[model samples]
Target: MFTLFYVLSLAIACSAVSVDVSDATNRIANGAVAANLQFPYAVSIQRIANNTQVSTRGHRCGGALVTLQHVLTAASCMFEWNADGTRTPITIGNYRVFAGAYLLSNDTATERVRNIAQYVVHPNYLGIPSYVGDLAVVTLSTAFASSTATPLSLPANNYNPADFTDCVVAGWGAATAASQTGANVEQKYANKYIYNQQECTSVYNALQGLPNILPTMVCAVSYDIVSSSCHGDEGNALVCGNTLTGILALHSNCAATSYPEIYTRVSNYTDWVRPIVSLANSFTSGASVLLLLTLIQMTFANLLS
Candidate 1:
């Protein structure tokens, strides 16, 4: 995931006003938010400190409400450690829809922000050693408030990776004009070039200098000029032909061309995902227990009466 300071320092500026989808396609400036994005699938996350208050002002990353109860995001977003070794609280809901000034119709377009009841980072994800296993699932206290809001797309049961030849990556990271933060985070769809492990490792060989890039990671290069994940775009979705197959996680670095943007292969983590989603349902099941208890109490009261 790109850091707030570094991504903000870049010079990729785009206006926040309504932009033509054509201009956004070409990447004339920086990028544009989706014109008629019926379901706002992406969410802007806010981190809060142990004081149980919003602290550590930082960049907003993207995520998907895969189920009514679970959210998928880049593990790096939660790996940040405090002196006490505790992770911060992540805020999710329609409240974040305000990010790109697309709030006029938010009543119908946004996912209601919900607090995470629990979270699970891929056990193998090494916080520092390698950021590759950078996937995590957040179970919200309640299922997201849904309307016409887009739901998370699940990886096809037996989908072929090679089939995803091209895709559009969208986010609201820092714009290029160094000092000016764009009015809202925007989306720009880019033509992506899928990179095989051997190829991507070779391209980014200078950094890791090893052929260790795993098949679990997918790399994509953008045809749109000045288009790439920057600060604040971490954990966004890489929608390939409308089917979201990956969660934006890493790249050589934010705004780097030689290094392709990397994502957490959704298919690779499906097994680990099953259990986390199961736990999310437990919260709802607890409510069922409460209802049962209430019923029993009512019967007892009737007998006493």
Candidate 2:
């Protein structure tokens, strides 16, 4: 019975995809939170191009709306190509800014109003051979509404890595039975920050034989075997204690055994994130000035008319 159980665990971990649990559910790991939980900004995304649209059935990832316009997410979730190898366009926005659900599993999420003004992926993101450290930003069509629960929270300027010694990961991902391909199902799991780069290198190699975990990433594991976030959970936020710390970039093949999920450390990439944010701010200021001038011109024209 012991040998059979071990083999079954490894097999489930090696499965390439994950499906959401509808009938039975496991006790979610790291599911604890403070009495009054503060919510981070959530952004919904879609893939499209000039004249074509892509499927959005499982098109949800947690994000932070840094400025009035910019929404940040893991680049791994957005990077894709067609048969011709052309870049695919991505659409991103706050809950009401676009038409989608926040928790995603919640019904009655069909309220599409605002459109995306621009979408920007980190140019430095390296995909294959190095599946870690993928991050990006999206500019929305307008400022988010202040009255909503989707307001952006500031990233901890100097995040204490120790704070995340044990953190929580929330997403609309499969509870178990690896293979993150299915209808959106929101779930949350608590995971302990197992170790840093040094340990991750050893753990990943021993488990999956991968190398160079990279300074831009961190590793996390759920002590509970049946409790975890899977594939579609990519790009979701890893809440360290109470502060939003990093973005869930990828896991070791869905739910590979003893292998922890890797995330793009937002704090580590602060240098890289600054420039992208600056560009968005500059664009916003320029547009604000342009709008002021246009309003003045329209007023003069109306006086003349």
Candidate 3:
């Protein structure tokens, strides 16, 4: 975690906004408080420290449940790349996912907590300072039985982010640019629109050390761009219509206008994610052969993308 200082510093420099890298759980910037069960797929990925269930302090990243056992999030949530271009992964046991949790304190009856069994960061993920291939699929220690939490629907094979409309981003990121301190207990969400890819690229590229936006990444913003997603929202889902089309890779200054947020397009990685969720769900269905064939098909689609 100490090595992340360099990466966090780089991000701060690029945004020209003060960012407190200490606690990961934060409030949404100028967004509405979400109704309970409204986003049953929203999950809080918190690093275990102190008595967690009711405690209000810890590092956390936002994520969505893609399956009872698998979660889709950003690689930046699980690993950190060093200045030397090497890497370090957070211990699997250090963090846990809380699904069906709208409020941070006392919602255990509705919340399903799970320890992470393992995770798969995209093979091409370059970690922070680079948002390319930022997605990761995390497997839970055990699958949840019928619960209040629901798995978010993944994008279609032909899902095009350019066609994305009526999207929403939900998280516990800070509400103001001035706050890099304190704790936020409830989840919040904001309506967003797909921002122009080329335009977004130009804006960030102007920042000296930032990486170029790739085709695999999608950009989004509020109607007025001033109210946007913030730092601690990393790894949360960007749902458009009824499908999960984006996984937040890097957030913009929530208090700044015109700078849009970026996410790794879920459509670009559907091929990689499909098999994991499908195979796990099909193991007891006696359809291994058909599943293998479908996996091969998705592989081709990903290659073409």
Predicted model with the maximum lDDT: 3
TM-scores of all models? 0.68, 0.67, 0.79
Give the worst 10-residue stretch by lDDT in candidate 2. 18-27
lDDT tens digits, residue span 1-305, model 3? 43244334335534643233234556777788888778988877776665543353453678888887789988887864355555688778777887766776643552367788778888998765676788888888777665657887778767875643779988887776566565536778888888778766766665665767888888887775555677678888999887898988777656545456778999889988998777666562336567878999999999999
TM-score-best of 2 and 3: 3
lDDT of 2 at 119: 64
10 residues in a row with least lDDT, candidate 1? 19-28
lDDT tens digits, residue span 1-305, model 2: 54445335544664542222111122122243312113435444433223333233434444556665666677755544344434454434322233233344343343432456766667777654365557877666666555443544545556647622876665544444433344434345456564555655554454342435777677776655445555445666776665567777665443435556777777766666667777666656567868878999999999999
- Candidate 3 residue spans exceeding 4 A from truth: 1-13, 16-22, 50-59, 80-87, 107-111, 177-184, 282-305
Candidate 1 residues 23-47, lDDT tens each?
A: 1111112545566453366655544
Clashing pairs in 3: 26-172, 26-173, 27-173, 27-174
- Sorted by TM-score (best first), the order is 3, 1, 2
1 or 2, which is superior by lDDT?
1
Predictions in order: lDDT: 0.54, 0.53, 0.73
TM-score of 2: 0.67
